[model samples]
Structure formats: structure tokens, C-alpha cells
Target: GIFFLLLFIFLFQILYWSLKYFDINNDASLFIEDLEFQDKLSEAIDLHEIKKSQEPAFFNPNFISDYKGYALGLSNEEIDRLHQYRKAKKWIYSAHEFQKITLVSDSLLMKLSPLFKFPEWANKQKVIGAKTKQQQFSEKKNLNDINLATETELQRVYGIGEKLSNRIIRFRTRLGGFVSNQQLFHVYGLEDNVVKNLLAQYEVKGTTKISLIDINTASSKVIREFIYFDREAANGILRYRDSAGIIKSWSELEKIENFPLDKIEIIKLYLSL
Candidate 1:
């Protein structure tokens, strides 16, 4: 009886160990499957992120924030430059102006410009309702020559106060009369929307004769006196002039390092070769 009892105990012990081994193997199998599933989920998430980035979405560049800029692949410096421009209360009217301010690469601009959604006024769309009665009357009377516009008359436009009107008039006079409507962009303290409103009513008549400065012969001081040009531009012109001996064509100035090419067209109105 003792031998039989001992044999029964040994068999029971063996059976318990076999069941425990099977349970452990089953748990290991489940853990391996779980790890595989986790890896696949991680890969799917990564792919989704990459695809989202590749797809372009329309956005207004003027309103870009640091986080948005980073997602759009803009450098920190480029983002900061855009923010600085906005902080000055200036608006970017076009993709070209955005590129000019941010100084982004041409390839990046091409990729991103298609996604830029500018304001309707930026497209030169006339918002009739936005104009004042005085502006509308002036347009109808054919007395919309900006060169002849008085401070009082200019103040009639929306958002054009006494200070802004005075600034515009002073700048116009300093420029010896605007040769082109494009010169309006050069006026200091002029808001982009205000300029648009003013343009809708008035045109640069070009009736006034302008005394353009001789580019080759003008002194740096004289060049700096022009509102469109600064000390840096004045120095660049002199350097280019010295190197080329004489600036025969306006296009040659484009080769000058750090030259403001965007302002060249308007700048040419006040300069002669």
C-alpha cells in the first residue's frame, strides 16, 4: 500500500509540471503576436504622417505661425522674418512679396506659392462698397489724378487720416510726382489695403514732368535721398558703378549683390542710365 501511494504522488507531480509548461508556452506565443501587432501599428502611423506631409494644403502665408511654418518646411530664420514683417503691421499682398520678405529658396517658393491664398484686394479686385462717397464722386468727375490730389481729398478715402494723408502727400512731393502707380508701394506708413483703396479712385496721370537722377553720375548721397533707396542700396550702386565703370543698362544693376530687384522697376522711374 505504501509503494502504490508513492507511485501515485510521483505521477501527480509529473502531470502538474506538464500543465504548467503548456500554460507558459501559450503565454509566450501570445506575447510574440502582440509584439508583431504593435510593430505594424507603429509603421502605419509613420506612413500616415509622411503622406500627410506630402500633400499640399491651401493656406494664407501672412498668417503663418512658427508651428505651421515648421510643418510647411520653412527654416526658423524664414519664419522669424515673416513674423517680424507682420509685427510691423504690414500685409503681404502676393506670393512674390512673401518670398521677398522670407527670402526662401526659389524651389521652395514654387512648391508653396501655389498654396498661397491672398486677399481679394491683392488681386486688384474693385470692392465698390468699400469705397467712400467722396472717392466714388472723385472717380466719376474725372479728377482722379493722384498727383493733383490734395491732403483733404486723399483723406476722404477710408482709413486715410490726416497723418496718413500728409505722409502720402509729402512722399509724393518728395518723389517729384509718382511716375507710376507702382510707386505707391514705396510710400512709408501706407497700408496695403489703403493703397489699394486709393488706387481704385486715383491713377498716376504721369502728366507731371519728373527730373530723374542720372544713375551713372549721381552721388551716393543723392541716391540715398530718394525714398525708395537706402544707405545700403546707395553703396551697392556706387560699388557696381565703380566696377562696371558705367552702368549702361538697368539690368546690369540686377547683378549687384544684395540689390533690391523687386524695387528696380519703381526705382527706375526716378533714375536715368
Candidate 2:
């Protein structure tokens, strides 16, 4: 009986030690799992911090520094283009204008545009919108006639001084009043931006009464009198008129080898078939 009791005690001790070891193993596995979860969480937090550090700050699109542009993922050429635009004292009022100036890719523009912070006036100028070419805004009320705008009024525009204003008036008088708004471009020293500003305030609202030159009968010298027509274009028109017999349609002039059909619309202002 004693031997049996001792055997039972030994069996009970073995079972208790085995259960204790098993419980310790289970607890160790749980601790390992917890430590692994903590490591993963720390890695995630570090990754988030790195990403936050890499994010670019908001900036004015007009005044993008080289480093800021690089951080924004803009190419060297695109940054140079922006610099050249601002060098001319031009302003970028919208993301569209910024893209148009820099020629940045649509995807990059989409990503960077949201971070642009423009001035209050620039934000208000958004109502004018932007275009790929020149920005053409509608004429406001009480705007003066460009054809009759006085030297004083012309001087009111930003780029035009006393000399430029007088020159503009002289050119208009020589042309017997401006036939088209584009004629302003013909005036020497009138920069495109200045012309855009001028046109925004004034326009060719009145028609100047003048006899249109008959293209079929007018001499080359007479044709050359118009600012758009040069000696070559004038001679080409005469040659076409001679060879084609009668210039029925203006399109026939397109076949005149070297004739400039590009200026047809403006030339039509002074000539007729």
C-alpha cells in the first residue's frame, strides 16, 4: 500500500511540473506576440513620421523657389519657365495660368496646385479665369473707345508713359483712326502685355469711314500702303490677279505660291475683291 501511495505521489508531482511548464510556455508565446505587435506599431509610426517630413509646404505659385519647386517635383525647364514669366513682371493668378506658363504635366499640376496660396487680389482675379494664349476679359462699363482714347487716358495704363501715349495717338492719326484693335500691335515699343491691358480698358467701338481698295484693280504700290501688306505680298497679289484674270474669291490668292493668306482677315479691312 505504501509503494502504491508513493507511486501516486510521484505521478501527481510529474503532472503538476508538466502543467506548470506548459503554462510558462503559453505565457512566453503571448509575451513574444505582444513584443512583435509593439515592434510593428513602432515601425508604422516611424513610417508615418518620414512621410509627414517629406510633405511639401504650401507656397505662392508666383514666387516658387528652386528648392520648393524641386520638392514639388517640378522639372528644371518648368522652373526656369516660371522664372522667365515672373522676370517679365507677370503674375500667375490661377493654377491654370501656372500650368500654362510652366507647361507642367497635368498630373503634377493636379498634385501641386492645391498647395498654392495666392494673394487676395489674385484670388479675386480668378473670376477673370485664364487662357492658353492671351487673357481676354470682357469690357467693363464706362470704358473709353480705343480709337478716340486721349494721350492722357492712354498714359493711365501701367506700361504706357508720355512718349508712348503720344506715339500711340500719332500712329492712330496716321492710320486715319484705328481700324482694328490688333493695329495697336503695329505701334513700335507696345509690348503684348501692355496691349492686353490697353484692350481691357479700351476697344475699337466705332467704325472709321474709308474707301476699301479694290484688289483686282489696285496697283502693288497702292496695296503696299497698308501696314500688313509688304512689297512681296503686294507684288504676289498683283501677279495672281494678272494670271488668274479676275480675283473672284480671296481663296484664289492662296494658290499664289508665296502669298500670305494668314493676314487675309486683317488685309480685308483695307481691301476688297
TM values, all candidates: 0.51, 0.46
Q: Write one digit per residue (lDDT tens) for candidate 1, span 1-273.
A: 999999999999999999999999999988675778899999999999999999868877867878999998999999999989876756677777888999999999998999997754445423445579997667757548899999999999998999999998999888889887756766778878888788878888778999989989987788878777677877888888888888887657667766665566567777898
RMSD of 1: 15.7
Which residue ranges in model 2 land beyond 4 Å of their true spot?
A: 1-138
Best by lDDT: 1
lDDT against the true structure, per candidate, is 0.81, 0.77
- Could you tally the backbone clashes for each prediction? 0, 0
Name the best candidate (by TM-score): 1
lDDT of 2 by residue, 46-160 (tens): 9999999988777778767789789889999999999898767577878988999999999999998888877544543455354423334335455678877889999999999
